[model samples]
Target: MDEARDYIRAMGGGLLIGLPLLFTQEVWQHAVLLPAWKILLLLGLAAIVVIGYNAINGFRADATIGEVVVDSVEAMGIGTIVAFVALLALGRIDGGSSVRDIVGHVALESIPIAFGASLSRAQLSGAGDDEGREEDRRGGQTKSESEAGRLGPFQRLLVAAGGALLFALNVAPTEEPVFIGVGASPVMLLGVMALSLVVTLALVFFAEFGGRRHVSQGILDRPIPETIAAYVISLLVAWTLLWSFGRVDGASVVAITGMVVSLGLVASLGAAVGRLLVASGGEREDG
Candidate 1:
């Protein structure tokens, strides 16, 4: 049936087109694809990127299902590749770095890691794009606040670090976070904040450039939306890097890392639910 064919295209777009490109690093990391530990970790990271891309496309539910998948795959793939290229460009890791080293450094060892930087931009950008589309769909939504692509390094760090810290401390309200209430010194917290700032900015720049290339080539559904998705994908993919290095400073940093890990779990769960709804023919409110 034509409908079945369409679904095939959608799955194909995401699985075939996106997976290979997004996991070139993974392929290099595990050419053998043996032992569960070897391929599973990297593949898992790639899976998150795939789902993150879908979430971005989910914002544009009016688009055809197959079309959305294709766009999502393209966006995610661009994000994964460019984040690495950014690492190299930034000289944090050389192209010559072993696959494991590059994966460890870029995805898990870096300060904010690629995920926080990319996701912060994506969230801001998604909010704008969603707001814009909602306005056009409703024909009554405000245009004053729907501007897209305005996320910057400082803002991303604030969102990721502040959000992570706030979420973490909120989970277990203790004297630690509340010390700020007493105007306590924040030397350690400030360091984590600074590290997050540096990591997030680098990811944003490279990922954005790669996403833009797809937009220019007419490979994506839309520039703004795809860019947002790419950013989210970058965030999810970079989780490994964030976790690997996050605890080097001790308790406070580890706590913040735990918060981010928790948040990633929540975000991933939401993505799965969204996919299920879409498969069930649920129309998105914004779209």
Candidate 2:
């Protein structure tokens, strides 16, 4: 059960950070354009980053060198699979795609995904650092006291906006959202919106991530309502980013809505994880 949960979290983290880049056309082109040596170099760099990150903040609290290497390899594998599947779902690659194109696309995109997987325990979970929280407990801080340090409702919304922007900003300016929005049917857009909300709720509440104790201490704290509120923030942020990027300019309402929903999928995940991060940090400071 524990290992299953860990793998799920790792997959979630990879998607959370990697989905934006999957939508990028430049990334798709990079796969075929870069020389083999450069591609190998990029892979090496990604491996080094994953290995170093595991050495520092891996899923386990205490991992030996062998363990870290194993963890890094697993993260890389998970990331590669995530990239391949996501690209396929987005229709970026297909059965018709050449071997070089497929390999380049998957390998290039997996770097960030693996990095995100490696940071799973730190970034995706609502839980904070285990050792730090344990130290706080030993320091005589009560649970209620820790909860009191959580961001207020308004503060959480603001942080959610910031997080949404952080994740969606780069992708928003690109052509992918427009391409997706224009091509997708109304049903597809609705599906995207639904998935975005589900992802948000899962990350913020159901993931059993660390620092969850500090999540819902504010006035508007119920799970469903709060998730709705965060989703709203993500949508608003997505709309704003699209408008600013001129992607929505002179567009029909249907097209605009599609674009917003497509980008909101990424932004909503950011909002969910962002609230957790800030809540954890605030608790630690108060403790």
Task: Say which candidate scores most in lDDT.
Answer: 2
Off by over 4 Å in 2: 1-137, 141-149, 214-219, 281-287
Please, what are the lDDT tens digits per residue for candidate 1 over residues 1-287?
A: 85554333333332332232233343233322234353345445444544443443344344466765664454444444544655566565675766766765343212122233233333434444655676574554333222212223222222333233212311221232223322323454455334443443333323332222121333333334333443353334224333332321244644544434333333333332222222211122222
- Most accurate candidate by TM-score: 2
TM-scores, each model vs. reference = 0.32, 0.51
* True lDDT of residue 31, candidate 1: 27
> What digit string (tens of lDDT, one per residue) describes model 2 on residues 173-244?
578888898889999988998898888888877774544543445547767788899999889878976764
lDDT of each: 0.36, 0.73
Report the Cα RMSD per candidate. Answer: 15.6, 10.6
